[model samples]
Target: MSPLGSRVLGRPDAVQVWRNLANARVNYSVDEVRRPSWNIDVHRTALPAERPGPPEPGGSWEQACRLVRDYEFSPPEIVRALYDPAAPLLGRDMLLEARFHGMHFYCGVRVTGVVDEVRDGTDRVWGWAYETLEGHLERGRATYEVVKRQETGEVLFVVSCHSQGAPTLDRITSLGWRLFGRRTQLRFYHRCAARLRLFVEAELRGREPLPGRSPAVGRLVWAPSDTRTHHRDALAIHRVAPG
Candidate 1:
């Protein structure tokens, strides 16, 4: 038997304190003791660790459209960067992939083909035709635009998607001849516009600050006027500290 009670008997002050206690004579028995279980140390083999599967390759045009629509801002920059006249066409595929990956944020319209027809002096007529795989067909139009440029081939104005039906193609061709003396940069404009619109919409929704603007500009630009008014009202309620 362990001498647990005798361990405290050596302190005279503790013994005196215990003796002065009211009703400190409670008693106990050794029947409460139990044996320890020593047979429960069995080991088992560990299960294999789970690993993530490979990233999904976005393959469908619809998937591409969704990616473009959902993408925040970066994909638009990629599209704009690809717009440079000097950039090789290989970047177009990359731009396409960016659009596909960011479809939920950007317009998921795809340009299937662009044709440039040049006639007269400096006047140029361009045709840009695209379709939205994700939106209603009524909302999507395969459009042709008439572009007028100076004699130096500088684009001055654009008549975008003004006409309808198969006959509108011929009308667009005629209008191009009437507006500009010659066709110079037709196909380029069509491709550039489609890609640029996606980029612009994405940048706008993501509240990206314009070039040369502070990062806080995004907050200012994105905040609605009503929100600003509400914030101003809230701040007006605070007391000004003595300066």
Candidate 2:
């Protein structure tokens, strides 16, 4: 059993916490996101594992999946085109601070689903997903998967997510979010797909992994307000569920 509990966020109603998060159903449904309230986005690319395989556990494909699950390529800077540079690593029950186009937001989520498999009928897939917690800006789930086609011997990387904007305290930020958030998010997805593919290919060729840049510096904390001041060098923090 997992150590995480039902309550994952520190603040449940920080903004749009309840209207449309990942907890609405058992598993993600691409079609359900078609509802008027939800905004959907998908990015997929082919990734060659470069080996013939049923993709057994501990194989290259699985290794790639582990990297994704562990957020090895999701450097704080790349996780979002523009970020605070101190965002926490992806994990179950973690709060995150994200910024883009001059807008900032705080949220939380927990690793809720995992995909591990061999050739199931025609494809071998492995990866995991994190479900939005109470204080999340968007109520939904994002899934990253590495798949290998059984017949063609091709491997692919897929990133899919279904979400809708939650209400935010700053209307200007919310407006900007409504207008350009999807585009920025799509960019993030594409970058992740490309990076993961590069890692898989490098492993296959016995080459060294690419060097990481601008690593995150500190733990996440809840920070809320304009009246109070915080140290510039403080560990990155998120004003998650309100205390």
Candidate 3:
């Protein structure tokens, strides 16, 4: 550990720290992760339609894709992400604060791939994926995608992942995983997609989505440049997931 890891815990340089960690490799063997046994999950939700072509300019598909790019769609009540916004989304390093029954645990993940393509006679897809890094609670890869149909102009948000628990030194977390992990995992997958849908729907309705966190909680400083404080200054009547 460097001096930044000292107990004093001053505001260390987040950009530089992430830059350094970006050089580090993911925790698990990428080769084996694709083998059988890892759990796979996929969730999809339809959004408002646009003209049958590329996503409408500034339409729901584009806005939803923006949220996915910046990690804004993540429900903070479940996970709060911190990273270098200045860095390109691909290969970016993320430090995630995953919340469980009120406990906060830190883990690391690195963006592994990105998807942007037009195929199948005119459909367009934009998305990216990240894999768990060393010290993560699990070994996994999750992808976020936004698809716009050419013929019908339908938009959809999709999340797919393959995951399994990893060995860790924390016994309590292991016990918690044994007892409540599956339930919370399902909740996370479902609610994350739901939250993204909520945001895009609100925007399509000509209103801003409300903040998912309390003003007081903004005082908590974890990164040098915290870009994950996503909700605020948006007009809305919608409520985010409760803590």
Could you give candidate 2's per-residue lDDT for residues 1-243 as a string of tens digits? Answer: 011212322323322332223343323334556767886666778766445647655556766876675565453442321122243333444444455553334455666777777655878887777765554556678787888876766777777788876553246445666787777777677667766777777867777565433233233222211112235313333333311
* TM match of model 2 to true structure: 0.65
Cα lDDT tens digits, model 1, 7-68, are 12121222222222222211211232222311111111111111222212331122222222
Q: Please list the residue runs of candidate 2 whose C-alpha ends up more than 4 Å from where it truly belongs after superposition.
A: 1-32, 56-60, 78-91, 118-120, 210-243
**Candidate with best TM-score:** 3
Task: Pick out the ten consecutive residues of candidate 2 with the lowest summed lDDT.
Answer: 220-229
TM-score of each: 0.22, 0.65, 0.77
Model 3 TM-score relative to the real fold: 0.77
Clashing pairs in 3: none
Q: Tell me, what's the RMSD of every candidate?
A: 35.5, 9.2, 7.7
Q: Rank candidates by TM-score, best first.
A: 3, 2, 1
In model 2, which residue pairs have backbone atoms overlapping below 3 Å? 10-241, 11-241, 11-242, 21-139, 47-155, 47-156, 221-237
Please, what is the whole-model Cα lDDT of each candidate in the order they appear? 0.25, 0.54, 0.67
